[model samples]
Target: MNKKTFLGIAALLAVMVILSAYGHKLERGSDNVISLHKLHTLAQKGEQLTWSDFENYPFEDIGSGLYIRKYEVEGGSHLLLSGGNINLAPMSINLVKTSGERIDIRYEEIRG
Candidate 1:
């Protein structure tokens, strides 16, 4: 009832909400930002997605059959997706992870 007691309860609720959001990072995730590592495993397993899957989330062209959304995760990165044609409607997906400096290279060059 007092100011101190009310503040304590509010603080506790805030922490719980943050923790709950973090726990669901593997799903569609909170604020549209999913864990990059979790998505990597799916990509490795040949999982794919379409723009419709995101309910038409806004994305900017990143070139090379790729596009990226505004949502950011840890290390200041955004979710990236492939801009493939009809045959590849289920586009390949990835989320950028910026550790430090970036290496400018083609996907195949680095992947190969």
Candidate 2:
């Protein structure tokens, strides 16, 4: 397989594993599961999202044409990359898409 394809698949798998592993804790009842674009309103104020805060957020960004799927949770967040360029700096992972839109995630775990 091509390197890009491999990396993309690997990244997607990694995200899926992380979500399927500890995402069952939230009290959304029956496994909230990756619910996206459907969110007309985001979480309440001051939620701990690595990066979900958006101004004039495009509905598509939620999950429409996504290849990976962006998820903002407490301990960590996950983003789907549609062949976007990723920038790694400090403690954050930022993926910039061809459209110039950016998605970021941080590598950290919250023990609560």
Q: What are the lDDT scores of the predictions, listed in order?
A: 0.48, 0.38
Question: Cα lDDT for residue 83, model 1?
Answer: 52
Q: Which residues of candidate 1, in runs, are more than 4 Å off?
A: 1-48, 64-71, 100-112
Error of 2 at 20 (Å): 1.0
TM-score of each: 0.35, 0.23
List, residue by residue over 1-112, the lDDT tens digit for candidate 1: 9999999999999999998876665454344544445434434434344455544233456565444433344446655555546345534455444644332122211121
Pairs with steric clashes in candidate 1: none
Deviation from truth (RMSD, Å), model 2 = 15.5
TM-score quality measure for candidate 2: 0.23
Name the top lDDT candidate: 1
lDDT of 2 by residue, 4-98 (tens): 99999999999999887555444344323233332212322222332334312221344344333343432233334232322211223343334
Off by over 4 Å in 2: 27-112
